[model samples]
Target: MSLARENRIDLVRGLSLLVIFVDHSNLSFSGALQHSRGFCDAAELFVMMAGMSAALAYHPASGAAGFRATASRTLRRSFKLYWIHLLMLAAVVAAVFLLPFIRDPALVREWSLDKLAAQPVRYAVEAIFLRYLPAELDILPLYMLLIAAVPLFFAAIDVAPRLALAASVALWLLAGIFHLNLVDFSQPKGLWYFNPFSWQLVFVCGLLAGLRVRQGQAPFAFSKPLFILAFVFCLVAIPADLVIHLGEYGETTPLRFLISKTSEGPLRLINALAIVYVVFNLDALQRLSPTGWLRPVFAAGRNSLPIFVLGEILSDIVTVSVFGREGIPLALELLAVFVGVAILLGFALHRDRAKRRRSGKPASSLLVASQPEPDYGPETTTEPPSIPDARPNTAT
Candidate 1:
């Protein structure tokens, strides 16, 4: 197999992040893609890809010394995410208070910044602990928690891979069965919107897949019957959710509650895994040439952290300004999304240029090829199975 770094992962990740921003914006006609309409969405894509990326980057460090190296990197990244979350929260707080003073009072009520202002001290502390997430702010803390625990996953896999996976599944089932989850300080009755206990199962699933890939094997066994079953499930799930409105039955259907997003329901996991299977086996999105038109997407994926933060900020702006407002056509809201993506692309380009400058590279090599990545896949005669410890893809 070719050892080149997988551009498809980056490409899919970038698109997923953008899709998330649009989905959160509540703009008209923006729900055409993945999310809400089904059991899966960008978040699933993000977490799974993160797991794969982590395995690719760290699995070689599976033994004693290597484990330390992987743990150190994981810890450094976890801290970085913590700091980044704090900065983003601070910015959101600033926006919450500043927007109304500078522009419109409606924003204060509209964005729900008043409560935060009312108890800044308490909320600030709570926010630090990820107990005061407003909206569009929940995913990062979950990601941070997962990243911190990745070394544990590596250890578990080293001991007995199947047993590790079973443990993850058991935790998810227990969380669902007992309604166990992280509590929200802001709303004591409510739980963390993206329950980490449930979500970790998905992350672990990805970890296993990535480990298998690293070992020069298909992530899952090729089972025609299994593929057909997953395929039928997807076929039925989409129309059930979108057309028949089956998800609405959750309130009435006792068993349906287990499929809820809050608990990271079992159906959601199945749907996401099915989608992932289709994507990997079909090479559905892997066909893009590195130098093709979608290179900006690769760039965005490469710089996902900054792009995600920027997208969240922009989504807030759209929520208050365009969504639910009269005289604002769907096209205009879509235009705003287009503009938001363009800005992200520009930011990525600027960062690329800066890195080149820092390296004292001449102008000729400034435009680095987005492809030609160091291979982290399974072995081949031409190259080693493992890639060197390069700058880690730190985004989740």
Candidate 2:
């Protein structure tokens, strides 16, 4: 793929991450915003897009060189994520420890030191990206595991993409059947937000999409009828499930349950798929380019990881200091927070772009540089064109 296309993916991922940050921050109005129709359900979209982006970025090539290249890139990303996880862990710990010193004693009292201490071993295990950590911990362990598993998964796809997808679906079903909650596991899953077993399907679907793209096939571009059907299905399924299940419908439904944000159930997965199909087929959406004002949202999507971490830390501070048990007001305060974060993200992106431009390279090129080079063919005699050193790309 061209550099521009890859950057666009980064932009999408950044946007998804931003929405997720806003969604998970649990600031007062998020619930209502999440419930509203037009709001992007960022969590599911982020997972799905992660899969799609992975497919687009790292599908296997023709020979041993291709396989080696793919493996090296995956490994580098996995390690990078590991480092990021460490940083996030440090941030969370720092926030927890220091918030009390800066904030009122009454506010500090609501903070849960016991909860942090309760799971030392779990947090330690999470450092390896094996299990899910507590919600209070903002890091995503499962995403790291998925990153580590990418090469293996891609190898399987190279041999038999369909088989790989089938296996993923089977595993997903099994995960649901066994109620395979990573949170229940003794080891920490990669991050609190992602669970490998359930989330793998999203990745596999992305792999399938990537395989098609690598084959020079368009992964999207639905017929009008199909698009309409997908749209109707999404509209009906989401609301129907909500109405029928109502309060009883936790994220976990027996057949489809994975790790729902609500309960990590099957319903969420279905909802995610419904959303994906609708978005994938919507030609009109494709026509909608990032406007000048909205470009920052795309930039946020590109640097989703840092922005997400920043938002989480910011939310933690706000909740611990200003809001505490009472919580921020649901209306104006929530809007202000969201707008404030958006502005900050815009500024960060602007600074990052300026830095990259000054350094004489594209930001996407920088991400590629940080990643390990693929170990495919013999070392090249000719040097590849140098791209700019941009910030590391993070999933939203």
TM-score list, all predictions: 0.83, 0.75
Candidate 2: how large is its RMSD?
7.0
Which tens-of-lDDT digit does each residue in 275-334 have in candidate 1? 777667655465666456876777667666777877777877786666336326867887
Clashes of each: 0, 27
lDDT score for candidate 1 against the true structure: 0.64
The TM-score that candidate 2 achieves is 0.75
Worst 10 residues of 1 by lDDT: 384-393
lDDT (tens digit, per residue) of candidate 2 on 185-284: 3223323334467667865776576455445455555677876776776676545544433444333344223224422456556666666666655556
Tell how far residue 169 is off in model 2, in angstroms.
0.6
> Cα deviation of 105 in candidate 2 (Å)?
10
